[model samples]
Target chain A: MNVGIVIVSHSPLVAEGTAQMVRQMVGEEVRLAWCGGDPDGGLGTSVQAIIDAMESVWSDAGVAVLVDLGGAESNSEMAMEVIGEPRSARIRICNAPIVEGAVMAATEAAGGSSLATVVATAEELSPL
Target chain B: MSKTMTRLTSEDMKALIGAMQAAIAENAERLTALDQAIGDGDHGINMKRGFDAIAADADAICDKPTPQALSAAGMKLVMSVGGASGPLFGTLFMTLGKSLPEDFECGAFADAFAKAVDAVAARGKSSAGQKTMLDVLYPVSDALAAGKSVGEVAAVAAEAAEATVPMEAKRGRASFLGERSIGHMDPGSCSCSLLVNTIAAWISAKEHAA
Candidate 1:
């Protein structure tokens, strides 16, 4: 399996929209998932939701996460801690825009790139 | 009175935590007012939500060692607070937990607090002189490292938060206002000072009681 790509954003629609872009860009070549919004569907990020997304897209090739804003990134970081150990070490949070990063990471992973390469490819898109 | 706790101890930590949480809950409107002018007007609600979660586990968190309790509270905040604030404030408490002794001591506490300030800056991707929480945090860290009393530190936090006024924003949602962010107090700074004052009041009262 290729490195997985997960999209995180403060808005649920934004997360799903970004995932749509990634899927359109790379099709079924790379595993993918997306999550956003708080438990109550508020304008915030949820650690639980992020962890669930990460788990859904987990692969030995590792996972790459792209976030739209600060809370999204931080909650994803907390999710990493919760994931812990072997899986956590494999995951990387890309410092790029959620939509662009997810697409680029998915495209690279579809080529069977490693986690680090996929992250670097996505982060190379734009600095956020 | 639940308005304030008069002592701090193993048992007192629960009451002190309650007081701290109450401090945020009680001032939620004031904080919301401040944010309404410059930010998204959710700082008060966000902070209260996090502190309320902390209150739910006050007994359990306080039962742990001081460092562990701080760390636990930090984790709680990250999961509950949300926004950029979740990680920023979370870094502050978590770093303190990592850097402090099992028991709290002023000298080590000062050093640890300084570390926490640095961690906050790193996590927020901003630094002092920005209209962010780092403005208050930096001076408070300095005051602590200089051996200022808890009361004095509290005062510093209050003053530092006020100091944000008239300064153009350099970071966070408030920064989008440009010069318009100059008048209102930064919501994050306000909440940080509120928390500092609550903790300090209880500690100082306990010292006087002894």
Candidate 2:
């Protein structure tokens, strides 16, 4: 199954950094999306930019969205809502420790697992 | 919020791992709610993911000595998780992991915890008034540093966390909102409170078990 990963944060640097880090583990198989950042050229205009990116990479397999802090989660939820009915169900939003989740997700993606499998793998890293 | 408690054993730390996992999972909605209020709304979700990874690895994590286990977990958080808070929180754990001596004793946990908080402050580039997790964590760490009881520290931490509601966001994502973020409680601060609270309970349990 195809797996997609999205990283959302107030700082684009954090998102970019996470995606880059994940790439080292999972290679090019993971779909990467960054939520909010300074609008410069085609990077993204609003949260919707992230949503659009998500849509482009999405398939029936679903996507996992990882967010940085408070509002990013809310915005992702809103984006899921606004992304309409079809794509929302496939998306799983994980609030675990960012680094751990990325590692788990990356590993599972490399293994060619479903969204549920990857989500389960990520949860195993929970702090308690 | 300073309350010094006993040192945690392997079992105690495992329990905390479980509690933290459950807290993040059960309160995912609340975390999202808090984030939605002032910031990105994924604080709960992101934290929950991080915790899940930690908890799932609990057996292997607890198998090691206290500090090593904590450090390993911290590294996982820093490398695996994404976001400023990820590295910040990860740094806190990593500091704790390092500060903990191989032959750790009850008396040293508080000092190590305080050091961990200092690391968080450094990583987040925040001080108390800036109204980030530092606002909540500082009071707790200060209490711990001052040799307060664990219960005492948790109480103060909870209070400080609640007090953050009126403060403006001065760092990270919420900072972008300026005045808009003032009335809402900082999500990172809130999560830190939960973490401190859970840690306190874990120590208490360990003490009783001993």
Candidate 3:
């Protein structure tokens, strides 16, 4: 299976919109899931939602999480904590900007890049 | 008065949560104002939202043993608050919960608090003097480690929080503002101080009542 991508944002619209852009850039070769909003459907990221999204798009090839803002990063870390073990070992949180990072990482994943390479490709965008 | 309790009873936990909720509510606007100066102006609102979730679930949270109650409260904050502090503070409580025994002594609580502070620092890749929550958290944890009384710890935390006002931002969104971040209190530090002080006050009140 190709590598997977999970988009995390405080705003549901931002996550969905960024996922749409990644889909357009990478096509159907990569698996993708987007999670955003609080448990109450308000602005904020949810650890449960991030965990669920990661599971939905899990891949043996590896999964990369792109998060919006600091809160999303914090919640994503909590999700990873509970995820544990071999699965947690396979996932990585990218430090690049959410939208651009998702697109770049998805492209690399679609090409069957390893998790580290995909993350590196995305992080390379930081200087831009 | 000697505060000798090793473990906070469920009732004690409830009181602490109550005090925290009230403090956050009282300082919400001030937190927002602080954030507006150097970061996103939503620290107060975000903290209030997280604490409100804790309050809404207080009945269930307080029914559990201390560790479980703390963990539950942390989870609620993680799910409700959507800012950097959400994860930072969530991890703080969750780690503290995980580190504690079902019944713990003050020294045990100190160790747990230190672990929780470490977890938050690692999560944020932050350190003391970054003008983030760590500015407050670091001192409080240190005081706890030193075996200082809760009142003394709270006093140290408040001083550290206030000291953040003149420090340069080295992490988080505020760091983007560079030197401009100075002169503004870090919102996370303010909230952290408020929580620590509330806990101190609650414990003192309980001691007085006895």
Identify the leading candidate in terms of lDDT: 3
lDDT of 3 by residue, B13-88 (tens): 7778888999999999999899888887778888999999999889899999888888899888887786777788
- Superior candidate under lDDT, 2 versus 3: 3
Which 10 consecutive residues of model 1 chain B have the lowest summed lDDT? B1-10
How well does candidate 2 match the true structure in TM-score terms? 0.61
**Span of ten consecutive residues with least summed lDDT in model 3 chain A:** A37-46
Candidate 1 local lDDT, A47-108, one digit each (tens): 88888999998978899999886678778888898899977999999988778778888899
lDDT of 1 by residue, B37-116 (tens): 98877778888888898889888898888788889999898888867687788889999989987755577788899999
Q: List runs of model 3 lying over 4 Å from the truth.
A: A39-43, B1-3
Candidate 2 residue-wise lDDT, A3-79, digit = tens: 88777766667777888888877788676655555223221123455577678768788888776554455456545
Q: Quantify all predictions' global Cα lDDT against the true fold.
A: 0.84, 0.73, 0.87
Question: In order, what DockQ does each candidate have?
Answer: 0.58, 0.04, 0.69
| TM-score per model over all chains | 0.90, 0.61, 0.93
Highest-scoring model, TM-score: 3
Displacement of residue B193 (Cα, Å) in model 3 is 1.0
Please give, as one word, the docking class of candidate 2: incorrect
Q: Provide chain B TM-scores across all predictions.
A: 0.93, 0.90, 0.96
Candidate 2 or 1, higher DockQ: 1
